[model samples]
Target: MIPDNEDRDDNKVYFFFTEKALEAESNGHAIYARVGRLCVNDVGGQRILVNKFSTFLKARLVCSVPGMNGIDTYFDELEDIFLLHTRDHKNPVIFGLFNTTSNIFRGHAICVYHMSSIRAAFNGPYAHKEGPEYHWSLYEGRVPYPRPGSCASKVNGGRYGTTKDYPDDAIRFARSHPLMYQPIKPAHKKPILVKTDGRYNLKQIAVDRVEAEDGQYDVLFIGTDNGIVLKVITIYNQETESMEEVILEELQIFKDPVPIISMEISSKRQQLYIGSASAVAQVRFHQCDMYGSACADCCLARDPYCAWDGISCSRYYPTGTHAKRRFRRQDVRHGNAAQQCFGQQFVGDALDKTEERLAYGIENNSTLLECTPRSLQAKVIWFVQKGRDGRKEEVKTDDRVVKMDLGLLLLRVRKMDAGTYFCQTVEHGFVHTVRKITLEVVDEERVEEMFHKDYEEDGPHKMPCPVQSSIPHGAKPWYKEFLQLIGYSNFQRVEEYCEKVWCTDKKRKKLKMSPSKWKYANPQEKKLRPKAEHYRLPRHTLDS
Candidate 1:
């Protein structure tokens, strides 16, 4: 019966028969028995006398080893000696003796079967000296008793021999002989030893072997006899000549010690649950505080993928986006506006929820200017005007400029003071950004006339004079017509004409004549003009 919480608090004992006992009973076998006397309600419940001197039977019997008589007599007095069968009754029985005599114990055995006809009868100590003695009866088959000191002795051998005068030579000869004892090959491998109580206190329990997970005992959580849980881990260092095992972390969980009765591990969740008589507590293996020795932070000082986020060091995805996610503040500038970007809205009386006021300045009716002079003493105010036609204008003023220093006053001044102001980092003196403000004074009336007037020849006014040239036919009508006569219509051609005309004194002397003088000159003289030479044909070319 499982005890209730109240019953447990009241210190009541609970007894439960396991499922294995029920299965054994269903098979018509006495598999469960209390050693010595069975307990009744208050005292010895019932005493069943077992005849210790029975012959071989095919089932196990439980009894206690008497302090005076020893092991052999104790086995001999059983009502039916059960020899377990193996290999289709072809193999010998295997016996396991559990000695609960005291704290120290040893137990295991192996045997082989022979034909019943060849087995020797037990004639006590005299049988070994005289050879086979008692006749073999069909009902009582002769079985050879293994020679003393032949098999490994679980206990001291002095208790076995009958007489003080008995020759010690036989026992000593048997001990020295190799053929006297047969080694018993264990059926299953030994279990792995896991230290669940965090520390290496397993030696106190005398547990020689324990099973490990897939032969890799990497992690060990030890629960102490007192409920303190210590976690120990074994790490293999390939760098060493012999890989060394080291314990990484040790933590004490309970303030006071209690006996840890059972330990269960959940690999899926990386959790360890320790069951104690008093309470059950769980320890998560990978929780920040319970990090193991092999943890990246504990072993490698700088984990590229992990960072300390104020409170704890945690692993994070190695992405630039994730880094941006953790940033506290971001400042963004748009045209002539600046704004502060926050991950979330701030809540509380300390923070203002209203939209932040922004200030701006306009120059030459064209350029827009803004500045963020982060300071506690000065506050800047901006005024903006928009006409009904949708044109915009702005002006800015600093309120607390009582007695500004030269540098501060110069910065506060408008476009006259504004060249391209570069943002210079205070620490490095590096130029970061260039802010340009250009200014020009404009005549408002002239600007309005220029924009509103139409000069497409549709107006009433005519040009002041006829738009034709006044120069005579042979004279240059401005420099452009002279250039056209010289085949210099394009800028490049004009440059070539100038180069050729200026190179000779004759051409220079002819160009020096005034327009009126060149026009009055004879056709022959006019043909002598440098520019006129390009249009006049040569005498030989006329004949051709």
Candidate 2:
């Protein structure tokens, strides 16, 4: 139940759902997303209608995209609805998640409605029809004394306090006319979010009202049937004079394409609860550490929950005392990193030092370089500085090279590809470097030299391999000799390479290694496994 009833005659309880259209045959509209309202303090009607609601009113909820030829693509099926209550009990924000089942035009949309508009719709005219052959139109009949849906408030004449003593004409009018004429349109007169991709439809939604530096912004966490949740916000563009929808984050809650069936938000913990048939997940509002330890990355992310607190990207806690709040910087609307992140000065080498990612490629073999921006709206650009000339050049695409969502793909890497690759992204006129990749292409000669080096005389250079060989009579394995030169960091990779090239079925190598600690796993089995599950998650945990 909503409505505090400050200026109105009654408090109301709102309803949102989808049902078969009344004029389905005439208009060819199969279904309609609807919003209904009923008086909360309702008394049973008189003799003709006893123990029934006397003030039920329903209105059409339209969500559509304007198409050509004066026709619109309508999202008629409502999948989910979220009512966000504010301080005003009467006016709450209504978020409707809608989808269409049209075979040719598969789509999903998000529509927002306000309580005032809904109340106006209920207070407007009613849809009436005289006969089966007649079209439905606004009724021009006489209204009752106290109105059909009015409650017995103190201001509206306190004569008859009960339904039994009320006028029969008002009861009859309320029973017959339940449908309103004026359809309740969305706040923007269109859908705030529309997805026509045939892959998945939006299943559920939860919203959090955030009070930013400018004003309160509604952040939407919309769950999809494909196991992904999209964090979105709407902003009004002053330049274009239109409302723009911005996607703040996209988190996959499940590895498989499991539809999200239920969701709830925790106000005290700042957590979102997601549920599927097989798994459940507790997602945080902000993953500040993933945005990189830089002022530019934190600011460019534009996450309302995150801010640069002069040292690191962290959850922006708006303190009431106001002393600690001045140092935090966050720009959710513009994402103007250069302007907003002026506290940290980028000198010269520190920018590249912050994002150090080294990649190795083999000669005449394929290699992939990954670089992903925090925001999906940003444009990724790859640049390379050659090792010999040290001149920067843009990485142009061709048949051998292609840009994908993950990163850049090099079909056949050559020795000349050895350089320093930079991954930069531009979003909202703010150019920020995502990462710096140091590419080192190793050929057959380098590989042979690395693995075939002679064992040093000193003990300081060895990787201290603890592999206990059962074959005591055989020659010492090449890995121990190579381990003396290669260091501990690259031992496992080199070991795998040497084992693949040297071992066979007849002489399948077996080395008793140190047992690793694992949870819910056997130490004997974990010793032979690739790696131990050092930090095992809950068995029912879903994907991030």
Candidate 3:
């Protein structure tokens, strides 16, 4: 059943019962509206107005015969005016006024007349004929009998002797005489079917409505009486002649037992909200595989890569089953090997040339040292590469001989002993199994130096240097000293020399610095300042 709240608040409700409303080409345009009613506002409260009928039957009848009586009862005030037949008559004739209250069989009426005769007759005694005299002469010889090929008397283009044959005769006459009148086709509409299973079963499983969520699938959410929510995916089955239902989620929220009154789904979130008699509950399925629900057995049986481990596939498990076995070691090994090979191929190709050169240098200087004993009791042999000798002799350093296990090995590693170490696992038969790795040891000095270099290269220091001083007569002393330091003493040569040196400094700083923020300052900044008297007296003043 649709929740009472859904129906109670008109503002929050949406009705989706037809195909046109969900069509992409229509662009959410409504083709037909409820009769005699207007859609004052859209779901989001936008105001729009549309006319129900463009033509009126009463207006058409009045325009056809100006002084006709009892014509209003057979004419619809809101019907669209389709045809005006004044040219066929000697005077004027009008038709196409549909009745609002009656069906086509009951209230439909039409009239035909000679244009010249109708005008003359209206001016004579016929215009004044009313009351008893008019009633008495209504069935007299003045009343015209239907005839063939005559506008006033034709019924299906044949002579109908009595009024009993009028309806059948008219239908035939309309079909035969296409020019005289044309049939109006009824508008196409979808059928309405109200579901009652949830209420009847006493379980809160009611499908309020079904909506197409694009061309792929139809989303259906059913509410239960016991505060249970079931989200179902429905696909149209042409062969079965019915929708194939797949349950996406079946959630129970009530601690006690309460019937769920209604449910709604958020297409954006793929979340389901279920409203019960007492409380409401929400279930979110983030990162849920929608296609997983369809042919879920295939996902479970055939695809070893995909597993049905969540609530959506939990239904496939037999009652009382709890544990699932782990994948075999052989499968794990194969999968890992394939992943490693793919990673090496892709990653190795894109490595920077400079980085590759550095790596090659490190590898050339490194030496692989195997244990002499080959196998030891309760002890593992680890090899470390110190550096290369001047003569290119490989320098082998034993990292540490430690007891087997990761915890014990980590405890023995000291500051001085840190380096790339490879632990060799040896069995009783003098067999050695090696896994090589390069470990880097970082000390406080190295870390600080790295930080200082980064600061000089990329931090505030690397920004454009501000002008230090402006001298009126001679060059500033600091500018002269800067020129001398850069091997240019003359003022004329200072600008060019300073530019090249500054550019070189910027490039070197960039190369030496890391992208990360520097944690250390330059050691030169820690030097003591010169005496105050040394700054107070200039070289020229001392010479004088």
Candidate 4:
């Protein structure tokens, strides 16, 4: 909310957007952006003004790009807004992000508006209607006594001294001519940023005041439709005498290409909370490690979220044990050749020492094997190696097999279920084994005892961990068939029969019920043609 400073005693104002009431009759359901004001002292608006606001005024907001030769491009939907207050300015300026409603011109635009302009539009004029069920137009005749959408003040005392006493003519003007005639451009007199790529549109905008090495800068954190957040800043180029927009980084928050619906930044904590249709994710504003191993790369990035700590590119200034290490520019960029920084050593076999092996189920009982990934960007792969097979097979979720939020749940365990099961996370071409459980099918009593012992031995960090994987179960039928036909048995139906005997004589014997019904046809006895009587004419012709 920005206050109207021109009238020192006037109430502060807030801006929002909503669809027009008559939008159903328009070419498209155009949205109306509006600015509303409320008195600072009005709390609960009680007594004489019960259930009523004495000083409340709102007008439509028109934030469109100026067109060539009076033909303007209107962005119907207001996506997001920010009110930036500076030390030099009395009132905060409004920065709004907008998008078009039509699918044909799918694009996004950024518009900046001044608080004074909005106040003037509200105080200027009211709209008039020539006939019923008609559109509203600016009144041509003399304006009314007290202006419409004007708040009550001691300077201009009127009836009740509030917007409530404003006549229908004034109220209609506020409603009709709420839009400003001129479009507020960015620093370059154009949109600050316009993205025409159809793949991902901008959704949320968050600005943080950053104190970089050079000076203070307002960094824009823009969330997009592809679950990615972009760090951008506007730099004033003195030589060119123009404003240039620079993108610092493109950060991926979600593995799946889901749109980011909401974003909030905490400068104090240096963390960003992102909300999507299915889940909410927290991302550290600066992941210096992801910037790669070069010192030049790290410093040249000029990311307010990250800093070069001499020894390494880090989220924070390297201190404590890291302070004494000799600094190098290409440490991280050279793959951390010394293996000193984070992620340099993969925690693989070290985890196996603490792994748990337990008997979990009876001949026909359900059991769960837990595995969770360290990073959401990684994909989880489950591996099962039954006893004596000496071969590992990729596990797939199916009827008797189900995958829980963090782990695989085997509905019914057979004798062959005894095996070493593994869950590994694949990220950035690196595989790290997250969990390993050697499963064994045993009696009910042993199963219970083993599970109890396993739970007791597990440390605090291993219980009820958050599931970090979202593997898709349903794929194309032909794709699944192709995977199965090529003996590419990685993700296939792991039935007891299919695993033990699929193409052997044992399978045929199982299909043939009793010994009496079992008949073996010799290869010589098998006839290639139809019955000899039906093929007699063809046989006679061949013989002749």
TM-score for each prediction?
0.21, 0.78, 0.21, 0.48
Candidate 2 lDDT tens digits, 62-95 = 8888789978888989999998888786688889
Q: Which candidate is the best by lDDT?
A: 2
Model 4: residues with Cα > 4 Å off, grouped in runs: 5-9, 21-32, 36-72, 85-90, 125-141, 155-188, 236-243, 293-295, 305-544
Ranking according to lDDT, highest score first: 2, 4, 3, 1
Candidate 1 weakest lDDT stretch, 10 residues: 535-544
Predicted structure with the largest TM-score when compared to the true one: 2
**lDDT by residue for model 3 (248-286), tens:** 344455655576665555644546666766766665532
lDDT for each residue of candidate 1 in 1-544, tens digit (9 for 90 to 100):
1111222221112121111122111333223211111111111001211221111111112333224545331111111111333344433332222212222332211111221211111111211111143221122223223332221122224332222212345333322221101111222211122112232222111001112211323344444555444433333334542222233223344445656666666654656666766766666553332221222221121212223332233432334465544632211011011112112232211112112211122223332232321111123332233324533332433442121211122223333422332211111111112122222223434444433442342243532222245535664322233333324334453443333333344544544745443221222333444431001100111100
When 1 and 3 are scored with lDDT, the better candidate is: 3
Could you give me the TM-score of model 3 versus the true structure? Answer: 0.21
For candidate 1, the TM-score is 0.21
TM-score of 2: 0.78
Off by over 4 Å in 1: 1-217, 235-243, 289-297, 300-544
By TM-score, how accurate is candidate 4? 0.48
10 residues in a row with least lDDT, candidate 4: 535-544
For model 4, how does the per-residue alpha-carbon lDDT over 233-310 read when each residue is reduced to its tens digit? 666666765555656656676767788898887877987788989988876666566543444334444555555555
